[model samples]
Target: MEYGEAQQEDESTTKAAYNPTEEDIIEYARFLGILEEEDAKLLFIAREGIAAPLPPEWKPCQDEDGEIFYFNFSTGESSWDHPSDSYFRTRLVR
Candidate 1:
């Protein structure tokens, strides 16, 4: 198996499931600096369908619709929404 596939299999076996709390989502919003504290709550709710506590191998990606999103490694979910314009700005910087 390729290194990436091997690593994924190892992680799938070893990692515990994660469910992100409102507070956790808010904290991530603050870290991204995309929304104000008050707005973070709404963002959390709106994105809850796609949200998971960020996993160790979380990475940013763009969807087919051209919307930026996050991929959670642990849960194998691709529901994380783009938090803010700042997130895209930061990614561009990188």
Candidate 2:
């Protein structure tokens, strides 16, 4: 196929359930100043599958004390950190 046709095909593709590709994630990471922050590595880890993604049922929240926490609605469990160490290594730098 020609380059123009390939580009058209890509543009015409529907993304009902869009998940960013590694290139997309890296571009975002770069825009976010990846080299200047530790938390930026988390994006790479998550996108590259080096770490597991957070469980869909688990939600992240902050307490009144301004600390991070994870709540698992499926199990009625809550914790100061993610249940999976491999999912998120540290608090998000937001």
Candidate 3:
């Protein structure tokens, strides 16, 4: 099988026998090397069920392609990536 197909099969098998926790997901993301450790944790907080809030001025938007982006009301600035992602990461770590 191709690498992507093999990975999908392995992940399915792992999920079939196990209920993964937030930390487990984080660790698995780290193992995949898709994101740095800190980034993975922040991603969980941002997209999973975490209750953290972004700064009031920043709003999240999605393009037609369904990718998320951020816009700052105060500065009228926009970015494809979250502008305060680093700040959120620090807050989550503390």
Candidate 4:
């Protein structure tokens, strides 16, 4: 398996699936009262896999979105950045 990809047991659908639809993304942002576009963009990228794991120094969150604790991918010079179940729920599935 490719690094960062998941195995059968990692399926989020079968698991606690946190796949956020476009609507969900918007709602989540509002729910958290995060109005900054950059933060929203980061969250959006995160929803689409442009996001990455929080830095080693960062602590893991108990939620699936993990946006609450998500560290910025880049401050001024960085760029770039899983789960699922039945019917090929990729990203989370493997």
**Candidate 1 per-residue C-alpha lDDT over 3-85 given as tens digits, one digit per residue, 9 for 90 to 100:** 23222223232225446666666666555553654553446433442243334665555545554455555666554453343
- Compared with the true structure, the alpha-carbon lDDT of candidate 4 equals 0.33
Between candidates 3 and 4, name the one with more favorable lDDT: 3
lDDT of 2 by residue, 1-94 (tens): 1121111112113233357776766654554345425565457544543234456776555565555466666776776544665433343345
TM-score of 4: 0.25
Provide the lowest-lDDT 10-residue window in model 3. Answer: 1-10
The runs of at least 3 residues in candidate 4 whose Cα sits more than 4 Å from the true structure, single-residue gaps closed, are 1-18, 36-42, 45-94
lDDT of 3 at 73: 60
- For 9-34, candidate 4 gives per-residue lDDT tens digits of 22233224554567765554444444
3 or 4: which has the higher TM-score? 3
Q: How high is the lDDT of residue 42 in model 1?
A: 45
- lDDT, candidate 2, at 19: 71
Which structure among the candidates has the greatest lDDT? 2
TM-score of each: 0.32, 0.36, 0.41, 0.25
Clashes of 4: 6
Off by over 4 Å in 2: 1-52, 86-94
The better candidate by TM-score, 1 or 2, is: 2
Q: Using TM-score as the measure, which candidate wins?
A: 3
